[model samples]
Target: MTIELLAPAAAEAPTRFVERHGRRIAYRETGSGTPLILCLRFRGVLDSWDPAFLDALAAEFRVITFDYSGLGQSGGAASYRAEVMARDAIDLADALGIESFAVGGWSLGGMAAQVVTAMVPERVTHLVLIGTTPPGRVEHPSEAAFLEHALKPVNDLADEEILFFEPASASSRAAAAASNARIAARSADRSPPIAPETYLALLQDRHAEDLFPDAGGYRDFLANCGIPILVIAGDHEIVFPTPNWFALNRVWKSLHLMVLPQMGHGPQHQAPEFVADLIKSFVRTRQRADVAA
Candidate 1:
């Protein structure tokens, strides 16, 4: 059976703002309830969202998403530090009049989410991290493995199966490809093209030595956080091993982990129902906590 992926669906007008650093950050939102910002993965934009995923969450909470500095429609040097990226997220929240809210992110965006939550612990009501890890991994993927399968240039990835969303069946694969192709087609120009210079600059400019907060700090922050957390990752996730998240949960007072099968780098895409359900469950837990408090 062919799964028909609906369009982007009706959404509120997207807003653009220049972060304090003068980098323009573009964001958009939908629905109306608790503020919920959906931070995206590396090399992604607002248009890359999975419509079905958006539809489910947008119905329950005020959904937020943005293009980060140096990517998508946000114009800046391709070299913004994670601190700057985290600040952009906080600034974006301020722009949207969101004082406190739940935060969720994937991959690089997931790392940024940690920074955002730590930077403004008071403003973040709950936290969700997916397919990410703290900086300078103690168990980083092998260089040989990266060379053999992961680090190829973007243009060279056409035939490689998307590690993020592994299509379990031919039908599912077709559906997933169609969805990505549609988004790719629509944002052909808007999606940030890989800039060798920009990518290199970000790689070279590492002055923000503390840009990615260390795992020790991540543990402390989550342990002391007054909110609940839902840490979701793919069972087959190769980006950051499950043990990393296990280490994080060990530090948290109230954090749970969900490892989904038939998934990888992007749970929001490959397991949208699971992701959406997790959000709903977390929101309910937060509400209960508030009532108890």
Candidate 2:
């Protein structure tokens, strides 16, 4: 499928919902090939993704993005735990009759992907974790001002940029503006913004520093998961700094890592084309390795 150069709009693909676990999970899929299920970051809805990035992936792979139950267009009770969210992802796949697929998760979504892959390693062929931190303590915490701004409503464009891009540089700020424009290109049928209380609940699990013990067991799982994995981050990431990737690499030696310069928490937005190409090439390599095995 050759997607237009422009980022895909929410209106381009109609939203579909599946009933599972007593929740109506809303999703939208584009492109064709090996199915790649994508989970959104904190407070992100199906429409929050950069249309250009989605179009790039869709051009070569079947990309699926959805809202967690009880958030956005999905109907259900709101929950915060990653375990529950992971189960929701699996149930949605089952509902769609997709037995096996690749998973790409960004930030909080990456956390959920790890849980899903850990629980059902036999079903996941590939894993992509971008701008995410490993389980356990958060080594690099965001500035309190930044965190406060993220929780409050975006009163202006600058506020939104502060959440995703670095403010110290003009070029980075410009990139953020472009990214935001692409995100809002599709105005119709947009998912409602996540509520403040709901967003707070979502952060409860993520902020639990002691959730993953330092024991070698968690590292062992990544090592023996028996799937190709890619971990991408930016050197200047404020939320999960580049060092977090190093922490994850210490345990998971097989991870394919990419660290972008002059980028923040949202490397995908800062370098969409580059990141898109990396995802495509990495997925292909993993598929070949799977066949050989």
Candidate 3:
């Protein structure tokens, strides 16, 4: 499916950068209001962001989107820890002189958001945790089919694309497959091949391992990491899936759950309006909270 490049918005295109840690980060600015930072899933680039979804979001935010280190036009670093990626978010925010921003990401990006909130609770005012799992407290283990992609090397992502979006119509499958192909071609020219080890590192960072060493460090994060957490999950997500999100909602009661009936892992992609509206609403609520407090 050929994605229509929606009408171009008069927004600034991001500049490319190699940070102090040797990780490449690309960022662009749009709109003007409370800052809304966009973080991508693991191994995704800034361009992979759907333009239509972004255009809708720019309607209300000074949206900032970035390519995570080691992916896309960005170069990979010697490190791939979640904390390090979290630092990248903070560093990007600091570099841009954004003292406070409403932040969120899709899938792995959402997990990275957790790291940022935990790192500096005061800096991130409104948190959006979509298609993610908080570390330690509880998590439904992903099925073998989902885990298979990480364990084995599959350069052709045709099979994986189907698992990403739901209502798996032929058009959706074809469009996703085409999208992956485009990304693969772009990465071939700009970045290194994603080694299995790197993929494993990300999975480990997200799961049972205690990055902070303390038994309840991460749990404490969910317990008191005060922020308006938006937990959006695709009813059809085979990767993180809905169960993982439900478990998250139970633990973090402040979180607002948005379950898209026919959607899968990428809510922003499958149901952009549902997501864009939620972000706008959350920001509004936060603004009210600030005025009230």
Candidate 4:
């Protein structure tokens, strides 16, 4: 069966739903290649993804972006726990008949992607984490201001700039505006925003132990997991500082890290095409190395 691939643009891709585990998962896909399932960040719905970033990724990958179960257009009980969210991602893949694929996530979504990789290492071909912290202890924690803006029901351009980009850098601020405009292009069929109360509940539930009960186990898995892992961050990231990943530099043999200068949490948004090219190169190079082995 030949499936038509949608154009690699946020405004062009149509929102679709699939039933899995008695719940409907909302998703959109573009391009055609190895399936890349992307999880959403904290307080982010399907519409929250930057259009430029998604379009750039779709150029090389069959990028699949989706709202978590119970969030946005999905139908289910809402829960932001990483482990539960990991199950949601796996279920989506199963429903789509995708046996193996690359998994990518940003911020909170990155946490879920890690859990997914750990849960089914054999099925995950690659792991891409953006602006997220690794499991266990964080060397440099997020700034308190992040919660102030992130928990808000509606984030204006200023809030977005503070949350994702480095307001201190004029170029970063300009990039944020451009990214916002691209995201706003998708005016129709957009998923609803997450409520403030729901996001608050997420923060409350994120106890230290609950977030990472067995940091040692997860670190060990990441160290030994043969799957190629890519970590992208901004040098000025306030939310999940880049130093946290640097702290684990020698721990993982297959781990690759890229830090964008003068940017913040959302490096992909600041330099969508460049980030996409890096990902394509990373995946291609690693896959070729594996085949050679």
lDDT scores in order: 0.65, 0.77, 0.64, 0.86
Over the stretch 43-124, how does candidate 3's per-residue lDDT look in tens digits? 5656556555676788888778776666555556624455767777888898778899888877667767777877887888
Question: Which residue pairs collide, candidate 2?
Answer: 7-52
Cα lDDT tens digits, model 4, 101-213, are: 99999999999999999998889989999999888876577889887887777899999999999999999999999999988888689999888888777767766643355
Error of 4 at 263 (Å): 0.5
| lDDT ranking, high to low | 4, 2, 1, 3
Pairing residues by index, what is the TM-score of model 3? Answer: 0.76
Q: Which stretches of candidate 4 lie over 4 Å from their true place?
A: 1-8, 209-216, 288-293
Which candidate tops TM-score? 4
* Clash number for each model: 0, 1, 1, 0
TM-score of 1: 0.80
Greater TM-score among 1 and 3 belongs to: 1
TM-score ranking from best to worst? 4, 2, 1, 3
Compare the candidates by lDDT and give the number of the best one: 4
Q: All candidates' TM-scores?
A: 0.80, 0.89, 0.76, 0.94
Tens digits of lDDT, candidate 1, 1-293: 99954324423234545554576777766667788887776556777677667767876777888887767778775544556667768888887678988888777677778778878887888878887765544444522332344434463323223556553545446546655654554433344554555554664575443435474366466565656777788776666666666665555656778887766666776556668888887877763133221
Higher lDDT: candidate 2 or 4? 4
